[model samples]
Target: MSDPTDAADLTIEQLAAEVGMTVRNIRAHQSRGLLDPPEVRGRTGYYGRAHVDRLRLIRDMQADGLNLAAIQKLVGSGGEEFVGFRRALATPFETGGAQIVAGAEVRRLLGVEDIDEATITRAGRLGLFRPLGEDRYEVTSPRLLTAAAEVGAIGLRPEVGLDVLEKLDRHAQAIAKIFVELFLAEIWKPFQRAGMPPEDWPRVRDALERLRPLAGEALLGMFEPAMTVAVEKAAERVVERIARDAEKGR
Candidate 1:
């Protein structure tokens, strides 16, 4: 099947396969009104890319131990804002300080685990921990150090969080570099050579005043943790050197 995001149509079976769910299961959720199918096309009913995406999202949340009820609640509460919020939340917030615990009450509302200072701090520096107000933060840090630490706690040493943070710092730098260059080169195209008419200038002029920073955040924001692996692979030598240095604590 074509990419669900860009595809014109997807059959029930195709949607099921794309989302790795059985046709019966997909239909069952639809029957339960958990998901909605798109417009019917010809003999085969087709779901839009958004439907496929929502299904995949549900699948991932289910995999992460969210029950259907919780998913529904979470999804429903956001509504028109859901897509934007989900897209934003899809990427882990990056920070380099204990911003989360510094504002622990909010995270408690989201059932996010309380992590140590390193996890909080690193996430803050990465812009992963978003400040709500009065020193409160949303446990949306990109590192997810607490989640990883919880796993290790059940079996191995907790200090592994340090390694994760160190690795994240290196990867975060690469992402920032990519985002900075992309905006500086592409987004600034109109302003590079000349000025605009006073009447028509607001959009372009305001974009410089407004969108430049937001675009920087949005682009870097989408570079999820999984992309870090791509960075590692592309710079395998750098990874090796970083790894060696970590091994020596230098």
Candidate 2:
């Protein structure tokens, strides 16, 4: 058995298996600057946990709808810079800490005693929580779980919260598509056509990091007013119905 602390002991095949990636995909990621080259030891390159972590991060970003270009920019920053950039990108959206709890505990946390299995599956699909093993789950975001719990407390079914999240996921996907198209057209394409000199990589990375916060701010700015308008219209309709009911009662 290879010592876990000895990173030099892992072969390419072992690394691929550990990270759940194909060897070709790992090489592709290395070419795209999303991963570092492995250390060479007597004609064989040895990979370590860092490579595994980078692969996992890339996969997570892809799951979050980021394309390779975006992932490259984020990961190309290197070391502390990349860490800071990733934290900046995540700070706006995820405010609470995560918790790992058993599946039974998840049901308790969600305030659903007899939750349907399909509803739990849908919740996982919508990024509510990830299954840890047979009977455990890692709640990705406590704030989201709290919101679900609150909704359930208000007499709505837990499945209703999952439905709402599914709708929001659809809307988010649409918005992501538009933004990616705009970014590709306005930013990446022009840079590519300009010959994409090696010297320009840092500038591109900087632009991506800067835009991360700006995009978050823009989404919040847009969503707040839209939500306000929606709430106001709904309130007006409810008021009108109440007034009509009062007149009929009189």
CA lDDT of each prediction against the hidden true structure: 0.60, 0.75
User: How much does each candidate deviate from the true structure in C-alpha RMSD?
Assistant: 18.9, 9.3
Give per-residue CA lDDT, model 1, range 100-178, as digits (tens).
4455543443234664666566555644465556666765543454655454656644345446666866875887677
TM-score of each: 0.33, 0.60
Worst 10 residues of 1 by lDDT: 195-204
Model 2, range 17-87, lDDT digits (tens) per residue?
Answer: 87778999989988887788889989999887777777878887776677899778656544334444445
Q: Could you say which candidate leads in TM-score? A: 2
Structure candidate 2, residue pairs in collision: none
Tell me the TM-score of model 1.
0.33
